[model samples]
Target: MADPNEPVHVTTTEARAGATPGVTRYVLGVSLVLVIAIFAFLILR
Candidate 1:
């Protein structure tokens, strides 16, 4: 058993391992734009 109140430390590299901020932002932006375009198209059709 481990201590319930023990503090755990984690480095930035370990915390963000396999994470890509730029690519994630790009994908999110593109998806948002596509969704808005689709809605606009439907509304204006």
Candidate 2:
């Protein structure tokens, strides 16, 4: 178990490098789902 009170430090470049790709993929997935839902709604309506 890790200590909850420990202070963790991350550099900007490291944070961006690690997070950007995953965040981009998540955003893209959500956007694709929304677009598909909207398209289906339009077609069915």
Candidate 3:
């Protein structure tokens, strides 16, 4: 039998481990966009 009101504990390392790849990908995507925009501005100006 499971307790309906019981709180489950998640380890910080386990939680962050899953999210690390996603965060890395997001940062890379943003950085690439910023680089392209800066280059375009420099070429146009």
Candidate 4:
């Protein structure tokens, strides 16, 4: 794993903005879906 102190690099303008817009929103939506899936799996199991 990489150290947190090291600066990270990204290639997106939306990443710099950091708001939940455009590509950012797509990433967030996928993350939210994964979280919900895990929660449902745990509860159902």
Candidate 5:
């Protein structure tokens, strides 16, 4: 087996081919905030 610590190679094209993980995290954070706001509004009413 190869060394696990060896650096893997990624082509430039491959690097740009996928959706960024940051965007997904941001979306999830926004949705969670919205859900919390909605719950708070309902509770306050």
Candidate 6:
């Protein structure tokens, strides 16, 4: 018989992989916003 704990581990792994793209997008968007803000500040100053 299969162990119940194994399924939980597998599900967690799948969930993390599924969220990778979302995390990457969030990071990229924040980076772009920071870059633009910095550039605007420099230009205005």
Q: What lDDT tens digits, residue by residue, belong to model 3 across residues 1-45?
A: 889899878899776775555688889999999999999999999
Please identify model 5 stretches exceeding 4 Å from their true place.
1-21
For all candidates in order, the CA lDDT equals 0.89, 0.88, 0.87, 0.86, 0.90, 0.81
lDDT of 2 by residue, 1-45 (tens): 889999988999876775445688888999999999999999999
Flag regions of model 6 displaced more than 4 Å: 1-21
Q: Which stretches of candidate 3 lie over 4 Å from their true place?
A: 1-21
Clashing pairs in 2: none
TM-score of each: 0.69, 0.54, 0.54, 0.51, 0.53, 0.53
Worst window of 10 by summed lDDT in candidate 5: 13-22
Over 1-45, each residue of candidate 5 has an lDDT whose tens digit, in order, gives 999999989987697997565788889999999999999999999
Question: Of the pair 2 and 5, which is ahead by lDDT?
Answer: 5
Clash pairs of candidate 6?
A: none
lDDT of 4 by residue, 1-45 (tens): 899999988767657775544687788899999999999999999
Off by over 4 Å in 4: 1-21
Poorly placed runs, candidate 1 (over 4 Å):
1-4, 19-21
- Number of the top lDDT candidate: 5
Q: What lDDT score goes with residue 3 in model 1?
A: 94
lDDT of 1 by residue, 5-40 (tens): 998789887888866557888889999999999999
- Candidate 3 RMSD computed on C-alpha atoms after optimal superposition onto the true structure: 4.7
